[model samples]
Target: MGVASKLKDGFLSAFCLFLIGGAGFVVNVGQLLALVILPFDRHLFRSISTWLGSGFMIAGPFLLEDWGGCKFSAYGEQAPPDSKVLIVVNHGTDMDWAGGLSYLARLGEPFPGGAKAIAKDTLMYIPIFGWLTYFLEFMYVKRDWESDKKTLTKQANQLGTSRLPFYLCLFPEGTRKTPKKHAQSQEFCKKNGYPVLNNLLYPRFKAFTLIAMTMRDQIDGVIDATFAFEGEHPNMSKSLSRKLSCRCNLICQYHPMNELPEGEEELEEWLRNTWVKKDALLDEVLKDQEAFCSKQRKYEWKQEPLDYTKFFALVGVFCFFLVGLSVLMIVNKIIRRGVLVISVITWVAVVAALVINIRPSKVGEKKPDPETSSRRKKAD
Candidate 1:
């Protein structure tokens, strides 16, 4: 966090943005090529696009190196490889979902195949990315409440039909992670005399119950991925961009998302109870960290060569390179007439990803919360 480090970090951030944009351009062209040449299986395309996105996700940490002290650990029974899971996680930053996916890759899980997320519709309209992912069949939701409910119902049905093992990652808190929200969550849990460590931002459960009930038959289990960032302060996410380079850890414990009850009221109660236990488990993890040895036990971390996969790794790199060059030329020569320095810088990133052809991964916030809302308010 020194001045030099801050300057270095700023440069890196700008570089990452350029690379992200360049990557998007390349990925778009790649998807288009796949669509035209790869016979006509919509399923195959979706799978490939998803895996491609995962690859981009994997490349992010290395290229950006914004996350510091990042870790992903699991609890309860680990889902069988390729099993469909409904993953419930505490959302802490805009990057939390992506961070979680990267974390999953480290845990030796098939990050892409098992992943499908509910995203805002507006995001789908964002140039290359939004279009390609939308075409590939990611779930898109309107910002309104009623529409989101209907969309959740539809997503459940889609999950049942899609046969591809899928896990839905939802931020029941429905927003970025913040200390105030975390403290509020803690207060709610304590006032109800519920377990204190299941401390999370207040979870809005309307759609959660629906998704669980709809996909009950297909879902192998419900994963409560409690993400805890170990640091010295409670306002971990307020300045989330700052923690990307500091030490951070995430404890993701998976518990069986029990069978959804038949009655609506019972189901709500069931979901609430499930969260209460999650709170306690979160507390247990936090306490253990406080008392544990300096040399913490290293959870499983695995990496494999991407080229082993069917054509994906090779094709993705080629596409990244091609797209980078094309964008650089277009922006420098035709579109911006070389006036936009940002565009020129982004092109360089695409070139780097192609030349290096390396990918690294991890997940979650990089700071610690000192107290939940209930505790913080009292201390003040």
Candidate 2:
């Protein structure tokens, strides 16, 4: 084709993508609105989450590094619908959080209702999604024993009664992954006689002890999520935000909710052994799926698909938000000192999404279609 035609085609494609992304945003906002009015409605959130998830699934291919091959597999994928879960994972990079969430959504699971995270107190104020995550029932820790104990107690009581499923994702390494951090964790495990694995930082058992005691009756199962990036990036930091044009791997092992060991001594031993086993399991899974880990899974669903007409209903809402964000950006430039406004908009978007996603915490509130559970099973 001639230069003019080529330019025209490029513009058209860009324009079409913009419109598609814009439409997705509007549907998401409406999904959020619908959730807010029915904040305690578990059924509503599941349906809305599916739509929003599809939006992300569609956009992810464009924005995330390899949108196609992200893999999620689980150990004990099945648990009682209403059971409370304690999720332990290796925290390595910024993409860890988003990658985990994306895998869960694809599995057709909304994160536990009122799920808590053992996170730095400052995460609540993070520029984009951090602010939104703040309102969820999180246990903010000061990285000290005494303070964490008190905070965990208070949040546990609150979460137990919220009637929503609760989960606390902990990073045993206490920070992002690095060669130094990984090496140190390995040393700690070796001194304790634990196996070495390429999966995550050395697992810390202290927090696990507290979690067992704090939510004893309420906690039903434990999940160990092992994350690994595709390709030969030295570490996660180097690969993050760079185009991942292929799928990533998230290997999850679901340990069925078991009784907390009887004695303090036994519990401690259990924690030590669990961490060692988890590391080994991850090594095997990663090795087997090295290539397919970055490839997409094929699953068939026989449900009613989205109504595009209904999806388009909220186009105006998305446009309004986009314009507002754009105007705020322009104002920031004019004020010269208002660069923080961009951060503010991002914060609002992230928080609003979480709020829209809230659901009942109690058991038997509503059971999502078993299909979602099955989809999640594959991802786990």
Q: Estimate each model's TM-score.
A: 0.68, 0.60
Best candidate, TM-score: 1
TM-score of 1: 0.68
**Candidate 2's residue-wise lDDT over 90-189, tens digit each?**
6655555555454443333344223457776655553323332443446677667788788877877665655555456777666776666677667766
Give me the runs in candidate 2 sitting further than 4 Å from their true place.
1-76, 107-115, 190-199, 228-242, 245-247, 285-318, 322-380
* Model 1 lDDT per residue over 334-371, tens place: 53555467656745654563333211111122344666
| Lowest lDDT 10-residue stretch of candidate 1 | 356-365
Clashes of each: 15, 24
After TM-score superposition, what is the CA distance of residue 256 in candidate 1 from its true location, in Å?
A: 5.2
